[model samples]
Target: MLAWTALLVAIVVSFRPTVPVIWGDTPPFVESALLTLETGRPTVAGGRDPGYPALLAVTVAFGGDLSTVVRLQQAAWAVLMLALAATAQTATRNAAGLVPIILVALYPGLLLFRHVLTADLLFAVFLNLAAAGLLVANCAGRTARCCAVAAAVLCAAVAACLRSQGMLVPIATVLVGACVARPDTPARVAVIALSVAAALALLAAGSRFGASDSDQSSTVFLPKTLFCNHLNIVLASDAARREIVSAAGDRADATMARLAADFAAEPGRWPVLGFFGDACLFDAALDRDVADDTGNAVGAASAYRSIFLAAVRDRPLAYAGKFVHQMAYGASVAWPPYGLEPAIPVSTDDVPLVSDIITRHGRAAEPIDLQGGPVRIGLLSDLPGISAYLFKALSTAFVIAVLFWAVTAVWRRRPEFSARAGIVVVMWAASIVTAAGAHTLDVWRYLVPAVPMVSLMLSLCAVELAACLRRD
Candidate 1:
């Protein structure tokens, strides 16, 4: 009965919005889908991989507009809720597990996903699919387990195709599966070896999906030099960033000054400093200057990567410290805040792709403003935040307790540790690591994959706490 209620609420919440949030990023997706149809190649939304554009291409084939695509994403959101519901049910071992799932379903903030055109929502869909598949495989008998494992792997691969960082999902699953698979599991070493092989295969296949000639497609921020790599340069202290940008050939001083001023304007973002890289990233004048500086070849992207790598080599300790800080920030901000109402759109007037989007999706294409905003679902928007806080608190104790149980179960050669329990821990850890590695701060959408893990952990821990209190 609880599952049915969650399903009904999810369907209603997912479909409540009409105006898809059109923002600056909408054009590339529209353009890519059109291009994909015309060229028969897996065209990309700007520098993004083919996973999302391929999805848009299918929608285009169905004669659906941007509206159709957002609806499709909404449907996926609904499916995610159902998947989480099942996982939570298993975790809590009772109706208490449904609490988080129901809270997620009613959270008014999630509706905002319906307005954007990013691959993250779908990528998350596949991640949860893989997680649930892992659970099924772990519990299934021999023949069934083989089928489930294959299905999980294929799902993880499709996820990797959608977003580059998603490559970690399959790799994490393989590693964890090897660790927790039955003691007599055959060819355990072979499985661990296959993780590396699978990751390489996914990366190679992802690059061919018509992203861009640019060196930085689908890896966090695109246009390698300007966003993803350049941002890291900005993340450094003033001295470090100065030294890093000094590698910009002829424009070194000017590049350093421009970035310094950009960071100066924000003054508060800290680890979230990627936004400062955008002016240089999207400025046409800067692009022309860069082209002229390097004789108009692929020098700009190469230079960015070279400079970023140098920073890593020179300031390895600094970079490592920053990476750890960001990971902690990632854990806190991982809650999904997309709501049904429209958000304030970020301007993309400087971006060259705006005109192209107009041509592809018609005049209606707008920038993607997916930042957190209000929802039509009343105070329910607060539910996601509340649950997130509770989940984090619960997970700390849960993981520790589970670790003890797992060790004991292994030591005794007992079947006490359920496979479902093992995969949840692994996915939770992998999700946090992958999201942090994306090096993004404007949003934490990359962390969506970890949410199901958090929610399931919440269900399990919350129930356990209640039982303990009653017994005491």
Candidate 2:
């Protein structure tokens, strides 16, 4: 009930018009939603996934404003996220498990994005729920297991539709389920194999059939073209084309067109095309520059594409070097400095405050401008820097601790701890590795879904630490 109250208040606060909210990828979503409402088509500025827009359209259909619907959903998800963290604690019998929820509640980055309309918050919620449900199902017997598997798969499918990263959960779930299922039991093995194959087939079909009108036909035809197809849509957009045109004048479209045509002409150029795509689309500095440029939003898009294309065409080595730099930077930090803002649109006057918070706190900076006065308070400032640093360091230590705990749990033939913790570790490791390998690693939003595993592991570590201290 307390959690529900907190979530309700947060949702109300998020709806306050005077709060100067920051929107990361939300403007495009709004555009898409409105477009879908108007024309019965999914058309966004950035050619984003249709999940959020579809959600908004349904809300609007029911006579709710976008802001009201979005804020309510976000708040509900945030509360649910906390509840999941608490449940994970109960499962592990760790009193300190609640600490992760508290930490997440105070996390400015998560708080900021929680109210936005991007897929990250929703993805995180569904992923965590799926994880928790799986844990519960595993702990219970066959009847509960069936329900749990269904819930897990449903949540994962929802997450996947919101963001491509969400597919990882289902994929990992299937893989782990298959590997761990008893081979001697032909029925179980066949069930697992059939389920996994069906899931994969559905994923592939969705990717192929669920494409929007704005999606580039060329890239969609190619296998292993996920990143490239996304890039092509981004590049083919009016904003991108306009930016190149403005930057290089007449040569802009021609140059970009030529580049696209060249790549299309030579299938061998796919690797080079991917390299350029990563540099232009994934670069943290580029994203930061786009965010910092407080001019017209379209102009910002144009400038970003212009800069990216120039970097790719003229200085390929420098572009690749920047990608490497961003990857290294992503691995070292607790959170990246980009993609912290809400996905909904914010006015020009609020850019500076948003920028300052994002830069200082990485993606965890959430500054709520109250209706009453000019007083600004950092929500997470209660923990001193040293203490926060120690907490984060301890979180990392917890990952290692959980590995040991999980190993011991397995050795003792406790499948509950072993399976749950093992799954968390696999997802965590996969998310980190995939993010690290990507061309742009600076956006912490991309890493949000994986944070739950980190939080869970950290909480486990904290419990273990407290236990050791008590014994000592």
Q: Pick the candidate with the highest lDDT.
A: 1
C-alpha RMSD of each candidate structure in angstroms: 5.5, 11.3
Show where candidate 2 strays beyond 4 Å. Answer: 1-24, 38-45, 177-209, 215-279, 282-378, 381-391, 402-416, 464-472
Query: Candidate 1: where is the Cα deviation over 4 Å?
Result: 2-14, 178-248, 269-275, 283-294, 336-379, 382-422, 463-472
**Candidate that would win on TM-score:** 1
Candidate 1 residue lDDT tens string, 10-87 = 567446554455455566665666667776766564565677777877776777766678778877888888877776
In model 2, the Cα lDDT at residue 147 comes to 51
Show the colliding residue pairs in model 2.
Answer: 23-342, 24-342, 24-343, 26-343, 108-364, 109-364, 243-302
lDDT of each: 0.57, 0.51
Poorest lDDT segment (10 consecutive residues) of candidate 2: 217-226
How large an RMSD does model 1 have? 5.5
Distance from true location, Cα of 161 in model 1, Å: 1.7
**In every candidate, how many clashes are there?**
11, 7
Indicate the residue-level lDDT of 31 in model 2.
54
What would the TM-scores of all predictions be? 0.76, 0.61
